[model samples]
Target chain A: MNVEQHHSTWVIILSFFISFILAIMPLPDWALSWRPDWVALVLIYWCIALPQRVGIATGWFVGIILDVLNDTLLGQHALAFSLIGYISVKIYRKMRLFPRWQQAIVVFALIASAKLLGVLIHSLFGSPEMNQPLFYPALTSLLLWPWLFIILRDMRRTYRVS
Target chain B: MISKEERKLVLRLIVFLFASIALMLTDHNSDYLKTVRAQLLGGVYPIQYLVNWPVKAGQSLSKNLNSHFQLLGENANLRDDNLRLQVKLQKFEDIKNENQRLRRLLGASEKLGERVEVAEVLAVNINQSRRKILINKGLSDGVFTHQPVIDAQGVIGQVIEVGIFSSIVMLITDPEHELPVQVVRTGLRTVAKGMGTVNRLSLLYLSNTELNTSIKVGDLIVTSGAGQKFPKGYLVATVIQVNPDIGKPYAQGQAQPRSALERNWEVLLVWQLEPSTVINDEFKTINSQ
Candidate 1:
């Protein structure tokens, strides 16, 4: 209802918007498997930073958008993303205390779990058989976490997102 | 966190989890959510276009960066190819006329009712696990589910999902796709299944005992118009490998798709000839009689 409040909310929405673009951007065949799960990574960052404001509801909605974007099942990503959001929200305090490298490790575990949930859901519908390539996106998300965390943190600070 | 707050969050999580699982089950088993997905896809279009904008700019910039010599060489080659194609077209027109006459003489019903419209590949799905590409054509362009798509080379795939302004195409190389094809040389029919890789399709359901000697490397496989999904005579793939053993149940073969499925930027959306054309053909055949 507040004009200023709506403007600041744009910051969070914009971050998710950019993440969606990166998630769908066409990559050359050689680099495709290693593409980071941009939506999941951004969802994790927001859940950790503003747990109450950007937790399960945000993840679930963004995930529905992702499901449509990927043209997979309507709720395939919604389910995974809500789970990611809940986990991050519950563990936000501990994650904030950890150093950046330690945070990266947590990021790896969270994303790996999310991807595992994805594979589980995929198997239910008989798509995307579990293979070595399934591991690469999570690994790439882990490798990108340090830089992404700082960048998003700076954006949140600059925009005073919370 | 307060116990009440924690309980609320956990409760919300369960709700979301169950809701999504139900959504997936229904979406997979039926088309109940097609309109919802189409509307959602419309909302997602801005992001797809935003991601494509820079890539399109880069491509246009690179196009102008070609040297004069290269342009001249390309022009000369194109001219030569156009001439050659025109000669082939002349033969094709005559052949079509002769075939139509033969069909009339035999009192056969009309065939050859396919049309094509051009579309550009807008974005490839970032999820490499699946072989889906988004094309610029959609419901607005009369694109529909199961419509055949092709490139200059041969059959590429078919449209799977149609949004308001764009559609998603599942390439034939996807593990989920199967095309019914007939061998040009031997008339042996079989279904080709995608092996979840680019440029390869595996022949399925060919009886090894009878089809073993017919399939060979370099043989051409094409649509047989079995299920009316694709029209007959579209080149689907060329046989690259064949191994038939009495020990195995079906004759085994691999095919190299004729289209550059992953690389082509432009494709043709094939449409069955309109009913008016059928009427015209019928009139022409009656006049011949």
Candidate 2:
């Protein structure tokens, strides 16, 4: 497999846009409250998959878009996502060496951190305090990570540089 | 090794962090971010509509099915239903005529108030912590910020956030939400606020000393019109619990709002009268006094 076969910047951008759509879909109230931060999760997967190319800048930009769409105070999500992306890039080599299950756990913690960061920022601005359903989405995303990785792994295998 | 490229990446991180901090500060504290918010939301609108396509389809399918059932009923059964409806209509018209005659005798306005536009609930954020719901109405649909929203049961919520195609409502059960309510049993008025408990709310600072009255369970509560946030006479809730203490000046009572607040299909957004006129009218009355 060659690096040239990997998805280009444009392809990643389009994929993120598609993932954003999935994130904002009007799921039922109960289901929506539990809907994992889909775009962030997807972005994290890609950032880990291709750390050299899509770095903190990509995360910050996409997070801004999410903030705007959700009508949140701007840059709140941007800061969280960018920080996670930076941390992921910094540890990409060590993270790659970890077992896949361990990697999923790391991703779970990182996503939870991003969500808590958002809650903290909102609360500081006098928004009413909300109980954090922190563990539910974290656990669900961790459980789903392996299947998501497998599907994307197959895509990478199919599009290898011959 | 801290290579030059790595240094550049670190520099990028610092720059972005600062930029994000600046943006967040401006967004939360200043009025300048609306232009940016508008532009970003405009860019995202196309994608939002595309994502919302399935929701619209599901709604249409349900509506079509309902109409189909109405169309497929037996003709004889329909005829009998029409006759029954006609008889009821005649009685309703008679009552309406009597009401109008009585209103004229009293020199009352024929129209009670402003008309309402019906809207559908498109999405709801049930984050128990931040209780907000979004409906498929916008400025284009004449929905403004702070408009009172009610369902067939009663006052469901109020519009707190508005966008181009949809508006978000903060429900009465939301922790930050409060409504001025009057006890129908005794005409005592107090502010009712969400207590962060589902199906429960508390009336704040109700002094039991002023009026030696006992409030029982199942007593009705209506809007007090004290703060002018909600119109007078709208049903707010019913007293579910009354805990009175002999020593305390105020009693802690709980009421369950008339609206389900959690689950409802349709809601009506009430357009309030313009505030400037209300303020000017108040000024005139104060000057005369």
Candidate 3:
């Protein structure tokens, strides 16, 4: 498959927007409590898939929007997202060589790190504390990574768009 | 060969970090972020409405189906109950009229004012840490900032942001929330603060010695109006657990919120009442001292 470089940017943006919509979608009460951070998951996937064009800067911008959208402390999600994006980009070449299952485990660790960083940043702002539910979404995101990767990978291949 | 764009990228990251620092400082120093929030939410609400439509419709369909069965069974039951209630209501109407006459004779203040508009909850913050919910009404529906929200059960929260078609409500269960309440049986006033856990709140700064006061496991707690921000007598919670230690200055207790705050699909926003402009002659005489 010939990968056209320019179209990959649009693919990334479109996927990110869909992730934002998913993140905001209302879920059933029990399900919502465990809903993954779809934006972060999508962003990380794109960073890994097309490392040359999408990087920390893109992640940071989306982070700011998510922070505003969720109304949390400024820079909480942005900083975490950018840092995670940077890490993924740094190892993208090696990651592309790994098996799908291995990549999913690595993505889980990255998402988990971002979640912890978010808590650390918010705590610096003196917001009231919460229990483990705040961290559960990250793990949930990791568990969804393999499926998301498979679906998105096929879309990129089929559309000839990517 | 590495391009100049690669070098520029490092500079851009530094710039973004610096910008974020400035934003953090500005958001901390003033209410400037509130305007940004309002504008962003206004723009995104249409998208939010689209995303929520399917879920809202599904919920409503299920609710309608469930109620339809009950409606048939309840039709005859409600008719009989309605007749009995009509008779009882006549007695209440007479008492209410007589009470109004006595209150006017004693120059008492009227408590219930104009009715309020009710709104339905459309969505909740996907991020659990923020603890915010969105309602279907916005500024067009007369919802303004800090308008108190209540359900049929009790106080829920207050409107914090208004969009064109929707408003964001900061729930009382949110970690940042604190409401002043009093024990109805003991008249002991204290501030109830959210623990960010469901169905629980802890009374802060109450003295241990006061634990002996008539406050009990089932004592009703209502807004004290001591802070005077919220109206008085709105149900807050019921004391569920109280523990006192001999040496501690305060007793620890928990409350089950009167409202099923986490599950309710609809809430009402209480509009603020204007204070009486007429000064009492008795108050004028006392102020001279």
Q: Listing every candidate in turn, what is its Cα RMSD in Å to the true structure after a full C-alpha superposition?
A: 2.6, 6.8, 6.1
Q: Which candidate number maximizes lDDT? A: 1
Q: What's the lDDT of the predicted structure labeled candidate 3? A: 0.76
lDDT, residue B226, candidate 1 = 87
* Model 2 Cα lDDT, one tens digit per residue, B1-289: 7999789879999999998989988877877876556456546766676776777788789767776557667566889999999999999867865775677689765333334778877543323355666677776687776788987677887886666667768888878899988888888878889876667788887776633574667889888777766777788889888776669888888899888776765788886655345446547967999
Model 2 gets an lDDT of: 0.75
Off by over 4 Å in 2: A1-10, A21-34, A68-71, A155-162, B34-56, B59-112, B124-128, B208-214, B245-249, B274-289
lDDT of 1 by residue, B1-289 (tens): 4799899999999999999989999999999988887777777888898888888889989999999999999999999999999999999978987887787688777456687999988854635677788898888889989999988888999998888988899999988999999999999999988988778999998777765477788999998888888988999999998877678777778999999998888899999985458659869987999
Rank all candidate structures by their TM-score, best first, as comma-separated numbers. Answer: 1, 3, 2
lDDT of 3 by residue, A37-141 (tens): 788778777778777767888888888878766767666677777777777877788889998878877877887777777667667777756766655676787
Query: How good is the docking of model 3, by CAPRI class?
Result: acceptable
Model 1, A1-162: lDDT tens digits are 577668779988999999998888888778878999899999999999999799998999999999888887889889989999999999999999999889888888888888888888888787757264666888888889999999999998987777
Chain B structural similarity (TM-score) per candidate? 0.91, 0.70, 0.81
Count the clashes in each prediction: 0, 0, 0
DockQ of each: 0.73, 0.51, 0.45
Which of candidates 1 and 2 reaches a greater DockQ?
1
Question: Docking quality tier of candidate 2?
Answer: medium
Instruction: After superposing candidate 3 on the true structure, give the runs of residues whose Cα lies further than 4 Å from its correct spot.
Output: A1-13, A26-34, A133-138, B1-3, B63-69, B75-114, B276-289
